[model samples]
Target: MIEVRGLTKTFGPTKAVDDLTFTVKPGIVTGFLGPNGAGKSTTMRMILGLDRPTSGTALIDGQAYHDLKQPLRTVGALLDAKWVHPNRSAKAHLQWMAASNGIPSSRVDEVLRLVGLTEVAGKKAGGFSLGMSQRLGLAGALLGDPKVLLFDEPVNGLDPEGIVWIRKFMQRLAAEGRTVLVSSHLLSEMALTAEHLVVIGRGRLISDTTVKEFVDRSSESTVRVRSPQLDALRSVLTSHGLTVREDGHAASAAAALVVLDSTTDAIGQIAGSNGIVLHELASQQGSLEDAFMKLTGDDVQYHAAGVEEVMGGAL
Candidate 1:
């Protein structure tokens, strides 16, 4: 497990991470989410002992990363896939790391096969594509078979198949009771891969919760109902203290109403009681991306004003 308590980092006059505190437990995949320039990379660097924290502590299994005798065996990380030497082959690179950590050279081939890089093990890492470099980095991370793993943008240059493979691979690692923490900007993939989330913005902790709970808390959830007797249904729903709004694209086929603070079953029961004929009734909740945008709307560091203007003008 990874424990971060009151973690803070600063560069010159700017604060990169601000007293961030969270726990990454074993047996689950925790997504580290933030917009660009949200101090995610800085925080990860501090966690791995690559950067010194201005305050607080980041611990791996109750010990600082530097204090561990065999750091790779305790915690493995892939921060930058392109940070390897250009002259070394994939196999040579892993062999060097294994030697440094006292890991046997025999384990090199195992990790190479595990990451599907066995075919390219003899190839120079500098000549590898971004996807191949990511695979090699993953192989190095797994060489020690550590209990804790951290990956930053693991799918950066991966194809669709590679993305799917990494998703399943991360899940498999978590299933084996390893503590896994991944950071990525791909909200859709993160929604599918992560069970829990730790969201930050402007170097501050915004949220830390499960995916289901996060979505449930979003105010975007509304009950969409369509019926032939639209006026009557709307009146009944409004009289019950429910806010009803017209669907933007009401058609002659049916009138649709969006009911706030209501459920499909409740709306259906009300319609049934009033002898109303309903065409459709369904609950529409905001997606993960929607919730994330809503939560971090004010915290985003950059905005495309032109894009916003164009979208607003179109609307």
Candidate 2:
């Protein structure tokens, strides 16, 4: 397991990470998430001992990263796939890393095969495509066969096939009872890949919970109703104390009413009782993207201008 407590880091006047605390237990994939400039990278750097924390501690199992013997065997990380020497061959790269940690040269070939890079083992790192480079990085991370693994944007340069492969690979690792923590900006993939989430913003801890709970808690579900008399239904719903808004994005010619914090049963009962016609009534559960925006909306450090402002009355 990975544990971080009171983890804080600062660079000059800006605090990159606040007093954050969270645990990543084994046998599960935990997502590390935050908006740009939210200090997620900083925290990960501290966890791997790449950067010294201004205060607090990051531990793998019960020992600090620096204190672990054969550190790579205890924890393996792929923070930057491009960190390898440009002239080094893929096999040469892993060979050196293994040598440093007293790992045998045979393990290098094992991991290269594991990452499907055996064909390119003799090729220079600089000649590999971004996707191939990512594979090489994964090969290195698995060189030690560590119990804990950390990956940052592992799918950045991967194709659709590679993305699916890596996702299943991480899940398989977790199934084998290894601890896996992945940081990525792909919310859709995170929704599918991670079982739990550690979300942060502005260098502060925002949430640490299961994926289902996080989405359910952060976003409100709405019922979408379409009818010829949308306005009339809106009025009835309003009279019943339901918050209703026009669903401008609906496909039908007649507008729909998006009733917040409502259910099909209640809406259907009211519509039936009032003799109102209903064409469609469906529950719209909030997605991971919706919940992420809702919880971190205010915490975002940068805001892009709205379309109106950008267009400036041109239309």
Which candidate number maximizes TM-score? 2
Q: Ten-residue segment with the worst summed lDDT in candidate 2?
A: 246-255
Off by over 4 Å in 2: 252-254, 311-313
Per residue, candidate 2 scores C-alpha lDDT tens digits across 106-139 of 9999999999999989999999888998899898
Query: lDDT of each structure?
Result: 0.93, 0.93
For model 1, residues 1-315, the per-residue Cα lDDT tens digits are: 999999999899989999999999999999999998999999999999999999999999999999999998998899999989988999999999999999999999999999999998998999999999999999988989999999999999999999999999999999999999999999999999999999999999999999888877853899889887899999999989999999987776666999988898899999999999998998998789998999988889998779659798885
Q: Which residue segments of model 1 deviate by more than 4 Å?
A: 248-255, 308-315
What's the lDDT for residue 206 in model 2?
97
